[model samples]
Target: MVSRVELFALIRRDARVEGLSVRALADRHGVHRRTVRQALGSAVPPPRKTPARSSPVTGPLREAMDEILRADLDAPRKQRHTAHRIWERLVDEHDAEIAYRTVSKYVARRRPEILLEARNRAGVMDGFVPQTHLPGQDAEVDFAEVWVNVGGVDTKCFLFTLRMSFSGKAIHRVYSSQGQEAFFAGHVAAFTELGGVPAGEIRYDNLSSAVRRVCFGRSRVETEKWVLFKSAYGVTSFYCMPGKEGAHEKGGVEGEGGRFRRRWFVPVPKIADISGLAGINDRLAAADHAEDARHIDQRTATIGQDFALEAPLLAALPVDEFDIALTTTPRVDRYARITVRQALYSVPARLIGQTVRAKLDAEELVVLHGSAEVARHPRLTTKGGQHLVLDHYLEVLAGKPGALRGATALVHARQKGWFTATHDAFWAAARAKHGDQAGTRLLIEVLLLHRRMAHAHVIAGIRVTLEAGSVSPDVVAIEARKHAAAAGSTAGDVEVEPPGPQRSRSKVVSLPERRRDSDLPPDSRPAPSVAAYDQLLSNTPKKGNAS
Candidate 1:
């Protein structure tokens, strides 16, 4: 069957080529004279248009639907009304007889018009402009929440990403917290890893780690620590406009985090502890290097190739490193612990009731008495968490031996693998041999060995003492020192003598045997002769009489 286009072509051809009249052409083509006239005017058929159809059922509820959609302009984006929701509202509130499809069709056509009207009234324009970035001049930094299975426990962590605008080269780091220290640390790590800092500016949202308060427009009151860090590194921070308006400003890093997470963190990387972040970051560094070979968007050069061109333009790292640790003076409690960031860390018992300085970074807390570091512990994530080192309370436990059985510090020590089965075995044996009170005191003395000796050496000492059927602390101390000395000895310290009746005695001569022969200079000196000395001796003998 001929379609309208084919029919039109036949009519037009008959009229033009054969010189048929419009009426005759229409009749021959079995069509109206108007159709022949239309074909004569244009070969192409006009597009069919849909006429406006009146909806009797939905027409009465138009005002209510418009009201709902109009209100949606001020509503939160996620909370705004949908077409189905509008239909539901109409049915429930006004008992209007309206099908969902009718309401959906109406909304699909009207919503954009309404939004455009609103935009015009508010005098706002919406459009995206193409961006061009200069090499080594601009970067974007942001922190994104990531889930990691660290130490067999699912933990929420923060991932810091700094992406260069021109090259698309990005540096990523995973941190336990998004604290100020972590913020500062992230920049330092990125600068060091990238071999230099962005020369122009690093863009950021109003993160609390950096910004204390958001002023009008792009102005921000930054935190003191952030200001100091930026100044020290000679960095210029570009704070984006507050809230959702600013999100697009750092879109490079914002999307980079998600892209990186999907590519690398798909399995929610398993790690041993917070300290294991180092390994994950090392993997990310390698991934960054691997990404250098790939091109971004329509760029001709690979990311790595672009970075190579940009690297030399970047600013050099600062000679003086900025301190990212938060320092505080907290008085040691009765438990011989200091409270930092609402977490407890045990210090020496002697420092109880005294204020000691504490320095906290992203991963660890260091407690100090004057210049001497008294204790160190991994930083805790949860509030009110206690990290007690059993060694810290040993001095107190020595006075009250019974408390050692039920001390919280002891429980934590066992959990941390600091108090092992060897220590427990030695404790039980000492109790069996010396009785409870005396045995406990002896165990404290043995525990004291850990303060001065390597932990493995102490454990070895305890094992040896138990195998020897002895519970004496002195015996364990002697065994521990012996293990320490044995571990400290090198193969070079052992005497290796050449095959001879008499051993070479000179330390200088021993060097040849100890060192590789190939490494030493050749023995090129001539053998000493006594012929000149013999004449001098004979002349001196004769001069003894003459003089």
Candidate 2:
């Protein structure tokens, strides 16, 4: 093959400069006359073309392989068939004698095309209409999973984000789970932070907390609680289509979740619990003002400026905030524990067989017996875990003092610093003096004193009693009362003395006179001086030297 430049040079030289005929140049160069004429006509060479070939093994099965791959588009992700599985199915079910690699190659090549065609048929496209939002008119809500280092333990946490579409402002909160209580609480917090509710509509996917049943298109059978919440706030809600088809509806919140995480939680916030997370969210909320540079309305104005314009358009807050707690009646078990959401919490042993109303929220579990709250526990995140308060079991332990030695409640108390080193020292001394059961009974009595006195007073009393080497419960009680009285006085507990009758004339009373050395008692008297006798001896002695 001759280069284009060389062909052009030869053609020009022979045809134009040397006056060579096209037939003469073609014969001399052993080339076709048409080629020489084309070269002479133009300097550019024609591109090479290759003939197409069909694979004997895979060509016949192309249609069947394509159908199999296309059917996978509707199958569950985990249940979808792989290329190797497809090959096995072809050999076993279809009696095709094709090699596995040939089928695999064809499936790999055609699977993406088949999936693309399926999406196209389903109306999933790249085309999106730019949205225009009115002030306080719309908001998008979504939850994203993020990794958090909580108390040195790495775990996945759900970040609930509500983004106002008009202002591009968002509220990001962290929760242990994406349960209904957390969902409701997130909304309450976001609304409170924004100072009002979005008036037009709040958009959400078919989250189970909101939608009890997803109907055709955007219609939904919403949960009863969700409906009540919507009514309470006087706001409307719009459900997006389920799954990937509806992601665009809440795209604002989805993007905000990512942006906020990258900007604030990039270091993977190290928090102890939900309260710590709340503190971080408060800081993030304040820092959001710095995002004023973010443009809204396609660079027409900044988000902060737009937000200022929209803040006034929001609906006034409701008279009262919603109580985002799940109320349930749970029977306390023999262990004096009630199971709420698979977590066990203790109540008084007397309520062991009773059913108590348990109000559970994101952070606390409050057990109420009729009108009175009997037990309160920090909500547990781990499933099947137990949170026991030693005080709740103290009454039962008093009866069975033997159980106090290695009880779970005792361990939990020690871990929580409720049972301090002073308590341990007192218990040890009591056990050494009395028998184990008797000593433990005494310790239980001391522990019961914590009900009346403050923990600090009880601890101080224990230290005082230990120093006095009196480990008796009576001594501890006395010391605790004295400490409590002192604390009360120091804390400004004042008592006014009654006013007495006015006496203008005062009585003159004299104090006892001071006694001389001679009038003092024998044991208290001072010794006489010997300085004069020593001076006489110095003048009379020195016998050896004076003689």
Candidate 3:
């Protein structure tokens, strides 16, 4: 159809500019001559009339569909009657022989109107106003699940995020699991990195780590440790509503987790260990300072600038940091190992049959006997896992030499490079000479030397003994002492007297020292002779054989 303005312009152009008649204009523009006359008589074109059409399929079903849709006003939001449901009802309930598509078209057209009317009746609001946050007043904390390649294994890791509400500054750390220890450790680390805790309140969802039980509405039974943590930081805790309804309460961190993951962890970070992950976090924190262009309080200011302003307003850090380790008293088994979180860690053999306190942290398991820390191991994630230190079981292994050959502890020791090929070579030679049991026993004795001697010296001793073709424990000990003394002398840590006649020497070295029989290095004094003791014994009185 031609527009009114265009038709009027065309008629005027033909009549005045071209000097064409109304009939010619009508013929050229493909219109009736009377219509062309009307256009020439007045600038306005006549309105087009609507043609009446019959609706066979939807004509009868329109009212029924509208009624069904209108009835949805009282139904639950999720269970509201859909257009397809209306179509099914029309066929099944009303026996109407209309095409489903025809019903779909009519229902789709009318459903919006029905919903509008329903909304008007219900008096529901459609949107929320943007909220303004005060500096150092609030922060939000949340965890997001991300996949990270740890030690060549693709594992699910928890990315903990704490976002300041005012400046939008955030701290992100990844952990192997979202356990209570990791949760607490994340907060401690984030607070330390941020330099302070929010002075007013820290908002969180109903995380299991914080909330022990959810009561009606916003009431909660908080976990005792979480309460202590908040107290230690001198910050109050606020919980968002449950589920999706409460998501907006901690919206800052909720969005931060996604944004950070997309920006930094897009390709799934391949980290070698937790320390590597911590390094990544450090880099991310440094990069966050450069993101200063983001807006705060409707003004163009850097997040770093806002954070600087808010930093002084935050609460001071406590003098003592909260211990985020999970403490337990586990009894040391006969193997001198304590079970913690389904993983076995070895303590000193002397602690066997005693209950020692085990502090299980995010990355380490520390075993304490009374006040002293007896053992520490990298916290294991696998169930039924064992982390053993060969030194911890050396005494036991020495007593039972047969157990040393195929011991699981020995396997772990070899895997860690603590037990080297030198140790194996020494053990094999000793066993060849002294027989299996005695040779293995001798190897265990050499292993015990690690306690008093430096590891490098022990290794050197092993090499020296192996080269000398003697697998004697005493010989290894002598070699170890010699190596230790040589190293100390070379490093200028020990003084050796120059060789001279014993009578000419100004100082008299003790018998034990001169003979090197007191475990001192041979260089301390001249080697002693037993010939003098034999002569003295022979010269002594022999009453029965007196001549």
Q: What TM-score fits each model?
A: 0.78, 0.75, 0.69
**Backbone clash numbers for all candidates listed:** 0, 0, 1
Task: Residues 86-172, candidate 2: write the lDDT tens digits.
Answer: 898888877888988888788778888887887799887676798889998999999988887876788788888888988898777
Cα RMSD of predicted structure 3: 9.0
User: Candidate 1's residue-wise lDDT over 425-492, tens digit each?
Assistant: 98899899889988999999999887777788788878877876788888887777656555652122
Candidate 1 accuracy as lDDT? 0.86
As for model 1, its CA RMSD to the true structure in angstroms is 15.3
On lDDT, the candidate that comes out on top is 1
lDDT head-to-head 1 vs 3, winner = 1
Off by over 4 Å in 1: 1-40, 51-59, 76-92, 95-117, 123-125, 425-443, 464-475, 478-547
Give me the runs in candidate 3 sitting further than 4 Å from their true place.
1-128, 266-299, 473-547
lDDT of 3 by residue, 68-129 (tens): 78877667779987767887888898898887788778877788887787777789544666
User: lDDT for each of the candidates?
Assistant: 0.86, 0.81, 0.81
Candidate number of the best TM-score: 1
Instruction: Supply the TM-score for candidate 3.
Output: 0.69
**What lDDT score is found at residue 127 in candidate 1?**
84
